[model samples]
Target: MSAAPHIPVLLRPLLTACAPVRGTWVDGTFGAGGYARGLIEAGAAKVIGIDRDPLAHRMAEEWLPGFHGTIVLREGTFSELDRIAADAGAEQVAGVVLDLGISSMQIDIAERGFSFQKDAPLDMRMSQSGESARDIVNGADEGTLADILYLYGEERASRRIARAIVAARPVDTTLALAEIVARCLPRQKPGEKHPATRTFQALRIAVNDEYGELAQGLEAAERALAPGGLLAVVSFHSVEDRMVKRFLQLRAGRMGQGSRYAPLAEAEAPAFEAVTKKAIEPDAEELASNPRARSAKLRVARRTAAPAGRVSEQEIGMPILNTSRTTGGGRPRR
Candidate 1:
């Protein structure tokens, strides 16, 4: 089997925050089985690993058998944790870790079409079971496509990039998209980042519905955790990190608004206590060793006895973008 691609970002902090001794733990993303393997190695009684990617499921099945703890790998999104936990007979998970965004394996594999650097097909679905990137770029309206790039990638030149993309209709390849995007930006300096990077990121996030999944997954994690349970997440971009930060702040009653003298109406007991006031970034050593670790930010929170809102597994299936799937070289209505 191929070696696991993920480096398991924020391992020490995640384990420390979760602190699983003998209870059940969940690795929601289970990319490369890194977090699951780490939790098991750290002495959890049982570890349940879940991923939407069928490839990840197969990899875990092949690799996690001889791990120290009892390992159970399931195939599904983290937003469906309730079903995963129920099926595994785990009453309450003591710890849950979600390493958000695509794993290194996906980016490194050129055929997955996750990176702008490599020439590959334009297919970026994480589950490998949905509409491909080709379906979106080649089908979606220019405005809808531009909005996705701006919101997901935080790219300032989104309109120009989207215009270029639309002008080049029936763009069926990764390099084709990347080259078009590159044309919209200034010529790169020797050490400057690739202009197509953000555009590719935007496409990947839209293709995978990653941020949407994260929101649902975070809410699900809160619901699935027992009192005093932990939820740990590592995000590689600002959009995700902001969500994690805001969610924790809102849950912990840490949002700075009114004064203590003002009597505030009692809300549901805060569901989480933020373990890291600010998200943690990798150290110099880690950053130097793995450049992919550069953008990663880890946020962790412990569950309170307080009630949390419910999130359904079906919610993840909702359409986030207005794009249509077209097959005959015609634009699909937004």
Candidate 2:
């Protein structure tokens, strides 16, 4: 199937924040190559486009060659973006751009199982390998399912929905699971989102280990970027946005002490400076062109000269769950 055309969310603001975008840059989540193309067109000497999904590479084959080696397409996760950049002959990149969440291509494809709007096999693996949503739905215990729904999707009726899922075991299709979840919630009103939306989001996040990857990817960007390098991330949901916001704040030395009663501890040298103190959202024109950009937010920061360091998962509010049984799923081992 031909890939759907994608409008890269927050592209305008991202380019503006990282202006004079010379030198090598890494498009960490290079879905549809939108950000990579934008970077190259906006003055980046080279763009290393990295994506875990094989479909992304396949789609790029048709158009990436036209760039004449300005854009190097690599099939890999952004969690190891530093390694990917170094292997591509760039030890330190000038910028890193990550668009968090599923790409339009994946969501629009019914067989990929990212959307509940279509009935297809329950597969949500971005890499097209490892445990799929079907495995988690059929194998995970009620408690694990509930935790995933609650922590990842922020669904208030996680337990109830999980119970319904358990009762309908061997659910192997996207619409089947969507129906089960919807049965547990109220009917959707005219403007309200579908009842199954949160459940589908939770399953997809678990199947792809998206939260874990996001945390590791941020650190990888920190290590890969040269001093004064830019890190621009566009997140589609609150959980993802909060994690990015907090990570940037902590790295920029904007984190506050516990309370007035507690003594202020010595702060480390800031590793980054905020390019945008607040998250940038799509303007009215962009929103009108693409309603999917409604929930998207862009946060940009510039790297300082300080050495790269580790960040605690708790500080970034990463969702924690026991994913030991699921192959290739869970937080990166420190």
Candidate 3:
């Protein structure tokens, strides 16, 4: 509503990769409706925009009306996108676009507590209702916290950071928890990301169950698309990009063999044909204009007539925490 502060990363590359973007499309992470609006303007007859965040729907009230009925906003996660599309009279959409990870809009707002830069409450719930960072930071066992940081954020100093976090009990604010994390590692240098970056990213991912949602959502997109329909995903980190890349590559039968868990199963036809043999990155112009686009990578594929198939969590390289992830203040056993 406030003029789309978030820029749709890799828009030009994504659009160019998905040229002739006609028919109904699904913008799964419809942060500020930038991708939805872009699709509609590029040629989509209608776009069923879906986002788990209620804030997105509320913020869209002012601008969505202007698009008339071309843009329909839905309050739900992309994991249920197939059902949402079916219910919206789009049983098989022409395309699906998912921008993975936290939205810039969420990080920009001080109260969201997504950014380590701001001194806000440690609340980083994407849906605005759930166990927040404060709950995890002040509660989760040291081992659990370590696993989360290591697996989710790929932080090497996860154990040390987790130890510090558990020692500094009752960390209430973003900056407070950040300070504790920063102390566990070397100080930040000029041009280097803050020491708390990985820790914060890990907590956000765990709190939101992003990797799990991503796996399910990818399968859901596979189910929701018609033959020849396009699927475009833009990821900001190595782990997420790896998951997307592996999912598409495996589904396209380019993984050289079937998933280890399903190696004995009958040969299934490739469900998708890779459109972009390699991931598309943002141009220098876009990166210069929006520094946030620096890490963005886009991958596009076209659905085939093959039945929607399953890909094991292991096949896509999704990081799985062996320990329990339930929210609590339980102390870690030695």
lDDT of each: 0.77, 0.91, 0.88
Q: Which pairs clash in model 2?
A: none
lDDT of 2 by residue, 1-334 (tens): 5557898988998999889889999999999999999999999999999999999988889998899999998989999999999999999999999999999999998999999887999999999998899988988888888888999999999999989998999899998998998889988789999898988899889888899899999999999999999999999999999999999999988987567888777778899999998999999999998899999999999999999988878889998877664432454445
Q: In model 1, what is the error at residue 121, expressed in angstroms?
A: 0.7
Ten-residue segment with the worst summed lDDT in candidate 2?
325-334
Clashing pairs in 1: none
- At residue 112, give the lDDT of candidate 2: 94
* Candidate 1, 163-186: lDDT as tens digits: 999999999999999899888999
Better of 1 and 2 by lDDT: 2
Alpha carbon deviation, residue 217, candidate 2 (Å): 0.8
Best-performing candidate as measured by lDDT: 2
Ranking by TM-score: 2, 3, 1
Clash number for each model:
0, 0, 0
Worst-scoring 10-residue span by lDDT in model 1: 325-334
Give a tens-digit lDDT track for model 3, residues 84-154: 99999999999999999998789888888888776889988898887888888877788888888899889
